[model samples]
Target: MRAFVLLCLLLPAFGQYEEMWGDKDYLWDTPGFTTTKPKHKACLYEKESCGCCLMKKQTHRMEAFFNLTHREMKKDLMLTKMYIDDMRASRSAFSFALDKNDSTECLGPFSDDAGIVFRHEFLNLGNNYNPMTGIFVAPRAGVYSFSYTISSDMKRAACAHLQVNGEIVSEIHGQDGQDSVDSDSVVKAIKLKAEDRVDVILPKGCIICSDKKFSNTFTGFLLYATV
Candidate 1:
């Protein structure tokens, strides 16, 4: 498979090999030299054998092959470097939870829709997710995986909406009047382009519970890059 790929890449160049490198005899004497030419094996197969040829065509072919191989290797190296640089610039991922270093509490039963800011960060390698506004902006085009958990007061609705660019993609809801902890979760994989916004929305009259144990959480990662 590897050889096939290289052959595909070099076929065009190989077709013009003789034009790029002229057919010159390697064993020929200089024009000014009068020395007697040494005898070399005159085999039937000029190319397939190691026998020294009268014109030494194999020697010239070997030299031209080395030159072409070097050029192809250099071109491949440059392309690999370009791809690595692009990947470094485009990487993005983040994981965060609500209310780190704080006791049990309920956040937001706000009058208007609000973004949930997760204060506890487990991993924010790319720093794409903003803790202040609870928003993640994609760095490049790719499929992304996101998982969020909602824990809220038993008396208030435990709900949250996964919004991408102001449009809701998924939701988790727990109705009021529960005797135990009201918790819900949603996991989704979505395709996004560069600069797309993602966030969890806490609507009016909704709350999320959090504590030192981190009952509510939000996480996202770049699943795979795309064109």
Candidate 2:
């Protein structure tokens, strides 16, 4: 009877062990559990590699966009600079006229007859003409067109010479024998170097009359730059 009781107890313990580790594919089996750990590690490595590739692609795209933007900005800046330079290079013109009364005369009979000073300024580009000195100093080397007018009062005569660097390039003369006033004008084109001086001069024993109507005038403009 004791033997039969011992045999029953041992039989229950053996059945429990077999149930715990019967199939190799079960989660409770030790060999199968260790194989799952290697598969988990491989999956993690693949995910990390994919993340690194995506990051590199994003960095490359950003770099390309920045380079293209930089090139466009540089081109725009160069164009703007060129336009500014062109505007600065093209500046040369002046115009002036007699601004006093009809009785005013730029008279000259003295030994040193410099010129008549036209004190009025209609337009003086480059600020090269001086009303105070009666001289227009060339600001750049270029071909220039100059025009001048002279008016004479009743029973009077007037004459003037347009001088460039102390040499006469043109002249204007007017005389009034009748009761009406008389006027004369002249236009001329000349090439000039930078710093060349130009002015209108009344010769010895010559007279010019002007009124509030600015009939007597001087004008000049650069056609194009030579240098």
- Stretches > 4 Å off in candidate 2: 1-69, 72-76, 102-106, 109-112, 175-180
Number of clashes found in candidate 2: 0
Return the top candidate by TM-score.
1
The whole-model C-alpha lDDT of candidate 2 against the native structure comes to 0.72
lDDT of 1 by residue, 4-86 (tens): 35544564545545565443443234355333433353232234332344223333445688888899999999999999998
Top lDDT: which candidate number?
Answer: 1
Cα RMSD for candidates in order: 8.4, 22.4
Extract clashing residue pairs from model 2: none
Candidate models: Cα lDDT each: 0.78, 0.72
Q: Which parts of model 1 are misplaced by more than 4 Å?
A: 1-58
